[model samples]
Target: MSTLPTLICLHGGFHGPGYWGPLVSLLADKGFRSITPHLLFGGTDKPIQSLEPVIEQVAKLVAEETSKGKDVVMINHSFGSFAGCSAIKGFTSKDPSKLSDQNSGKALGIITISGFFPEHEVSLAAMAAASRTARGAPDPATAPQLPFKPTEEGLLEYDGDPVHSFYNDLPLQEAQKWAAELENMSQFVFATGGGVYAGWMDVPVWYLLCEADNMMELPQQQSYVKKARDSGGDVTTREIDAGHSPMLSRPVEVAKFVQEAVASFSR
Candidate 1:
């Protein structure tokens, strides 16, 4: 079997796996394999009340591939990175001599696109609230009211225009098409804090920092990279003049970066 590490693409909140279609096809054309799973937190099912399901689902997918003797590279975008980091525990730093016959593959690397890297026990919601308050928006507890709207069904949807927040670089028609597909994610997702296991602390990491991201401003993204670095993480960052959804607006660029990350496992 060709032993190229599989690419596991994890989409952000409010997005479905379909959003990865363009990038997946591009990677496929280059002889790379990818799996894009729909995280239940972002699904239309009953609202997900905890982060464990998202983490468990991703961990299950990785375990399946690794069991097949195929190493995996996680490509985590936006809120997807939160689950990815927590889910990657125990999958890194494999010892071949101690490997079980059923599972030998290891995690090759992690790639985060405008990812959110919260401290241990810190929820994404708290981080956003603090960030907003620092910028003179509102009290830390009330800052969430500006950017997200709680649906009657208890889910959270982007309050502002998605085109402005997520797809400012795409053409108007394309942007609108994707905007209409946005779903209401579980409000509890941002409330869940990170676990003790954050794979970025141990695995090789590449961060695609979107310079023009309206949703996650460049400074905030830079701060994440810096935080990870300060904690002794091995992170390589590439700045792109694109919006938040580069996989949709700049597929070729995103594909090239993913390819670069996959190639690093060999070097």
Candidate 2:
């Protein structure tokens, strides 16, 4: 019997591993092992102001797991995908000398759920700019900024209501419950952008598109899918009939897709 790859899940901005509970529980029921790390840049008690450290943290985890001879399958959501991809770069670099002992791992596949997958040399900021241009909105540089507030310690908090944006498909009470738990994410992560790791070029990738996602519109998600394919990624896609937070609104479907992705890794 083939052992299933260990699932290393990375949650979206303003979220922690806690956000993956529903999906993880389902995977566990099916006899799969999973680990969801709390990213330093997101819901941690101490805030991380940059992306590099977050990537390094994830890389270390991947290395630790793979060093035990465990194959890994990384799953990422929203902005978490950036850090996940970076970790893959850190691990599978062609130049072995450049990789740290704690940053080496073997990844069997990558699964992105409503996540951003930037093309080479294209940052998330650049993608946002392109999205605005496509929508005929004013240039992002000149557009009015969101109503985010910076703390006394200089951390930016996401003050926008997520109900309409992320939890539109959830029941009213359930949406309110999760919204109350949302944390502030680093604004720096959004302002900075860069190309994804070249490691993704050779990995099998599955993109789970949320068709009704108001947070990342369907058109924008499709653009990322195209970029992934153009960059030589062996891309497979599945569309979910839910909003942005599918793990919450449609856990069973997400779990089934995850199972399928794992099964494809061996074939």
Candidate 1 ranges beyond 4 A from true positions = 94-103, 129-145, 194-196
Report the C-alpha lDDT of model 2 over 192-264, residue by residue, as the tens digit: 6542454556478889999999888898788888877887677899999999999999999999999999899
Q: At residue 39, give the lDDT of candidate 2.
A: 84
Weakest lDDT window of 10 consecutive positions for candidate 2 = 90-99
The runs of at least 3 residues in candidate 2 whose Cα sits more than 4 Å from the true structure, single-residue gaps closed, are 44-46, 90-105, 119-122, 130-147, 193-198
Backbone clashes per model, in order? 0, 1
Please write out the lDDT profile of model 1 over residues 102-221, one tens digit for every residue: 456878889999997655666787777787676778666854545778888879877788999999999999999999999888998788774624678768899999999999899989
lDDT (Cα atoms) of all candidates against the true structure: 0.83, 0.78
Error of 2 at 145 (Å): 4.9
By TM-score, the best candidate is 1
